[model samples]
Target: MAKRRFGRVRQLSSGRWQARYAGPDNVDRPAPQTFDRKKDAETWLVQKEAEILAGDWLDPDAGKIVFLEYARSWIEERPNLRPRTVELYDYLFRLHLKPTFGARALADIKDAHVRRWRKDLLDNGVSAVTTAKAYRLLKAIFNTAVDDLLVRRNPCRIKGAGQEKSPERPVLTVAQVYALADAIEPRFRALVLLGTFGSLRWGELTGLRRRDVDLDAGTVRVERQLIRITGQGLVFTEPKSAAGKRTVVFPELIAQDLRAHIKDFAQDGDDGLIFVGPDDGPLWNSNFNRRFWGKALTDAGLAKIHFHDLRHTGNTLAANAGASIRELMDRMGHSSTRAAMIYQHGSHERQREVADRLDSLARGQLKSGSGTQRARKPKKAE
Candidate 1:
């Protein structure tokens, strides 16, 4: 056979065309199957050469691994992933990704399949936010696969499909915050107040120690959080990011409430838990929400508002108090300004005040102009 430019296409003894080429590793590998036509074999060699040139060539057999196995390994081998994050990935895989792509080979999954799966999820009443999460996880998994040369290209190509559209929650006024604080139990009044004023998350609030709260300094040092993992009770771990470990100063209002809470409810020693159950043991979010939070909401007449919204309320209040973007990010324990921007947006009342001020300015200018014209009038030219 004549020497070809990229690879040789030779006729096998069985009368089929076979393509062979030396891969990037300098290994001589042949086509998996023989082509009936010489042109088809030549085209296959052309693609192989193009892949090699582009540094995207992967062994055909490498991507044959089942997606379920590969995805599980990916999640397990992720470095520095938190326990809660790992749990969420596992759940999302099992509930959303596994059933659709579990048995399929990694290479066989394509953009069309992803689009179909997302459509089916929405058709079956799955929330868009949840579907977005699953899509993002799948994208991450495939991204790893691409990096490992297990797949040539990622299939998650739907634009904006991986971005979650979360609905804005209601931000409580300062008065409403106090109302909820008064409605909750004495021991938990500080929880409501801090969640709104200090912008502390549930895990941070539950994880606080007496030593972490400095009444003298009027600041709380957030260092750790209490996260509940499945098959494990509650584990205290450092905050997820370096930015999460912050020192947030509380106003005198929050300080006074904290003092009362410490005197009436917090544990005795500095090492003791600050927020606990009725028995002074560590409080769980589930227990608080089920046993206490729901009743407090009803009593405060703020039904349908989630407890997490209290943190949002606090961030909004801080923004209203002229907290800058960086200050909001620091106070909210967020590593990025994206979340801070969301919290720093103008309130409806603030927007209304702007319009009201503009109207007053326009009316004042009109009255001044009319008076000047009247004063300039010369007795009807008499």
Candidate 2:
């Protein structure tokens, strides 16, 4: 029968105290269980008020949203995700997150559930890398759900679960690079050459146009990348970052090969496709690997080498050629910059100078024909 400062408490006919308060949503919320005494009811009201004042109070019913529905909406709402990124997220959700958490409400999901899901993925023979990707996607989705007030907190609290610990890729020697190039079909020889010497990504290679490559300048411009979506065959998209829209100077020594590639393989016109499949269609990674890359690796006598490793080898060659990290970032089209590097992109001339050094290094490595530098062991107890 008495009015409390925070909430009004009423003594029911059953001699129990019922406490009710107006929530931030302007709707009255009653305590789930009534208290036996006035003091207890008052204490409940005080705690609720404290939670509201501390900005830690959750809307009681907001988290009733289903995880699947919320996640779908989240993907739709994200404007900045690339098509390939959207495809990847969709794949992860379908394969990993959906079966376990899709039907559950946002509030019902907990950290324990997340841990169990991740463990199940690993137990079922999912690669650690794939599991980490799934965990990161789940964490990102829950993060947005929290911000949108759909959940009180993100349930992805496991430490380092989202971090990927993939094994280091093998880097090929200069001679091996040339061998792989020669072993591949003649048209694709330049593809492998540019992939290494120009440090171009697969998408960048597939997306190349006649105009993108400047043989006279000894440079290749990254205007866009060709990405393949599940339902969609191929789509050309602009670089995601300003850094990706860059000019990467390749060694002049490789220009003759490039010139021949363009004359023989590239489609007509300045805007014509530079590197097309035998059918003149944009190169599909799977098809290329099966039809060309796999056999080339066999012929070159290299094992466990990835196509992307070409770029890695180029990066290493550049570093060994005395290229600064900033220069590497510039050539690699890395959007994220290191603190010491400060995103200071080198001038075209500076890049060309680095390219020249790369040329010298490649020549030396080709002459030496060493795949790996073997470290000398010290004599024991001499």
Candidate 3:
């Protein structure tokens, strides 16, 4: 019963070894539970001592911080995050995470809790994609807690819980694209053309100015996007990534249409907005989606088509036009290959074209061989 150098271990009446250590606060604390053997208890004490020496030791009681408090603090401390990204994280917390684990202590969240939360989300009619996003957000927050030594390990270990398996979106054909452009109001026709041909995003298209489009040069410069942050209204910020800042060549097929749109619809001055609503202000996706997008689709007889599908159409067309992965990435303003690769998948029609070409080549070779065999048959024994 002599005092040890760092801590002490003693056998309880039940023959289990118990370890106690003096924490950084100078208060003696017992291990959460008893160990089966004295060796195990001694090993645990050694780790605790090492953690103290390395200044990585966190008071066990500190892990009891409420989940919402810690998560909010974690988000607020990231001043470098983009405004839109911060907005999304905030939304996810409010909509998905807060109702479930907000009141729970950070250390009280277990693997079963996370698993049940995910299952409940799915059972409550949440789409699998949304559930996956929520799971990923939770996993990321818990990972940071682990690094801070707030927890021993992350409990979001459910396999494939963080992946989003979105179904393939429908891509508009060339004729459908033109029909949609024609069906929309004359002032907004150019928006459809630019979205479908240039593969521009909603924000990028709305962020355009008179000077951004060059009819003579057949190019459109994407320098910035207009993002509507919560309570901040519409603010102009640079592209989400370096690749997003690009110059896309507008197809000559839409040159006349774009020229007419600029002359008739674009605001006055070089910095004037190119695409605006009926009130001549910047176009907001919410208003557009509510007012015009559905009408345009109905007018064109295109069912189950979303406005963003126009961009998908453009990317698919670009990939079918023999664009390599890097070219597709540059055109789509994606910093990674995964999205560009998805667009680069050979279209059914393009795959059919490949098969047809191979069949034609085989037929031509067979015909040539037959002619050679007839020609070398000693002139038909004449």
Model 3 pairs whose backbones collide: none
How does residue 356 of candidate 2 score in lDDT? 96
Q: Rate the local accuracy (lDDT) of all candidates.
A: 0.90, 0.87, 0.91
TM-score per candidate, chains pooled: 0.87, 0.83, 0.88
Put down candidate 3 lDDT per residue, 1-382, tens digits, no spaces. Answer: 6667898899999999999999989999999999999999999999999999998888899789999999999889876789998988898899899999999999999999999999999999999998998899899999999998888789899999999999889988899999989898888899999999999998999999999988899999999998798898999999999999999997899999999999999999999999999999989889988889889888999996777888999999998988899998988898999998897668999999989999887778777785344333355664
Model 2 over residues 1-382: C-alpha lDDT tens digits? 4545787788999999999999988899999799999899989999999999999988988899899999989888898888888988999999898999999999999989998999999999999999999999999999998888788789999999999888866777889999998899998999999999888889999999999998889999999999887888888998767788899999987899999999998999999999999998889999998898899889988895889999977877776666777788888888665521432344455578979989888778766866366345687995
lDDT tens string, model 1, 1-382? 5668787888999999999998887788899899999999999999989988987789877899999999999999999999999989999999999999999999999999999999999999999999999999999999999999999899999999999998878888888888998898888988999888889999999999999999989999999999899989899999989999999999987788898888888888988888899988889888888999899889989867888899998888888777899999899888999989986567888778778989887778777785343334355754
Question: Model 1: clashing residue pairs?
Answer: none
Quick one: best lDDT, which candidate? 3
Candidate 2 vs candidate 3, TM-score winner: 3
lDDT value for candidate 2?
Answer: 0.87
